[model samples]
Target: MSNLDSQTAYWDTAATTKTFTHPLHAPWLDDVNRHAAILDYGCGYGRTMEALAQQGFDNLSGVDTSPGMITQARALHPTMRFAVLDTPPTLARPDASILFAVLTCIPSNHAQKRLIAELSRVLKPGGTLYLSDLLIQDDERNRDRYARFAEHHDAYGVFETGDGAVCRHHPSDWFPSLLADFENIDTRRITVATMNGHESAGIQILARRPSQAQVGPVDSFTAGLEDR
Candidate 1:
């Protein structure tokens, strides 16, 4: 997409309106380190980056595929680094990253896997990855509804959307296996009431890369926990 169109879709007023409706802002802010190098993956309009700055994080950077979005972010946060990323990113190997509502926009499972691998690569040992995205539920009705939404959207590589909302859905069980290369720290579901008065469900996952000291042969129980 051209820079202008991308900005319209991701950095416009509507996008800002949609973002604040979610609960990710406060929690993510609480979790990020103020002094560590941080990346706002899929940072639309740089809102989260701004929020991070407000929290006293100076070593912040943002990456988005849309040049328009990047432009808006750079203009708004002049001191912060903003870059256009078409594929796998190669910015600073950060101590942490905030990936709020980003993975769901990836079109396929393979793409998700690739992105996770890239995240692992870009993070330092013992670094943290915080991710939030729409999640598949065990309820048959919810599962059916989610599947229909995915089908209707024709979501297929870098971008996906449904019913005027762009997103991809993943099961709650997906993260453990997908992030097995990292040490699983925690996982939970969060229910958000959107501004339009609709309730949506998503998963919040926090994981850390194994520290250098913890990389040796694992105990049986620890190894089993790794599978959990």
Candidate 2:
């Protein structure tokens, strides 16, 4: 099976059956405009979208890679729109139209970059993007696992789960450089409660797309009309 299929299957079967208690986007959700167009990329079972709707966000939409997840999301949220997509999503919205994005699911470097590019394509200049993902732990056990995973995968900090799915973790210092196109607003480490009732180290990032108005040099004063 392709990696996408593996990931879909992993989420549909294993992740679905477990208990998930993590709070989604708690740090940045309130800062978004209530009426702004929001995309919940990789929104599993539409939980975050549903929460956003409860918080009075009317322009919320979501996309997931697994059809099973989408089906469940539709059942749980009858009024909201959700799409099943296995590839990097191409949103119907025009360029610079989206105002907020909550991305929580990409694990590989290529997929992460691809989704970031797509988010950048759809999000308005000065729009906010919130991302949370696993971080490469500093312990020797994690180091050993990363070293072993390097033998099988081309990227760093990757590991194969017992269920045949691969997940990548990023170092703490990596995201600022990776998201250089955006203005880094904040980056912090937070403990997340996982499906298996374990606390894992995670990185939460808040970034804003640079506004077009801020791109060029600005003249502080009129150079030719100084003596008027």
Candidate 3:
């Protein structure tokens, strides 16, 4: 678990150098309390956090593995709490954690699963989990990269960008199964611009952790993470 993630170094060095434009719809979080405990686990420069703050939502916090990102986030929004994660996938928030396109930065299968498991642990039953991430595109360039890296990477959608960061775009069926631990409230497919300014397929998932009475231990879902 201590193994360094490939994206971390790239992000930290280029922290103030990039801009993220992934869409985060405010209406999706309309049901959540304005003061509910909200977390953005891989928040970049605190864009989503600021957006929620503008919506009259307070009590929001963000954590990221990149010190540069945390620094930039803190500078951008001094009122909001931001932290640098030393041992990632190990969030201390003990409700209603949220993520915005975080999975796209984590290219490996196991790393992504571990982060999801940690999210399940921190989130309270019935808490909202809003996730936005990349999706596989039908374009020839993307398909070629998927095939080119298939032999080395775990997922076909995993590919390297010209700027040298490894990124993952999920298969359509992969998300529903991966997030089986959560009850689906809504899911939407949208077109979004990547940080590099390319239009790509994206997804936004609004879900809730099942009630305690309706499910088994969070560890059970984590066990399946390992089995995969």
lDDT of 1 by residue, 1-228 (tens): 232223334434443344433334355446555677777767766776676677787876677765666676677678878777664533343334567666655545665676676666656666777776766545565456566655554532122233344445565667788888887777677885532454667677777767662432211111000000
Best by TM-score: 3
Candidate 2: residue 142 lDDT (0-100): 65
Residue 107, candidate 1: Cα error in Å is 2.1
Task: Give the clashing residue pairs of candidate 3, or none.
Answer: none
Misplaced by over 4 Å in model 3 are: 1-6, 213-228
User: At residue 102, what lDDT does model 3 achieve?
Assistant: 75
For 1-228, candidate 3 gives per-residue lDDT tens digits of: 433353677887667877787666767766667777676777768887787788887777777778888888889888888888778888665334556777777777787778877777666666667787889989998899999987787669888888888778898788888788888888888888878877888888877778772432221111011000
Tens digits of per-residue lDDT, candidate 2, 139-196, equal 6866887898887776568776655556666777777766777787776677776554
Model number with the top lDDT: 3
Give, for candidate 1, the lowest lDDT window spanning 10 residues: 219-228
lDDT of 3: 0.71
Which candidate model has the greater TM-score, 2 or 3?
3
Write down the TM-score of every candidate.
0.69, 0.79, 0.89
Q: How many backbone clashes does candidate 3 have?
A: 0
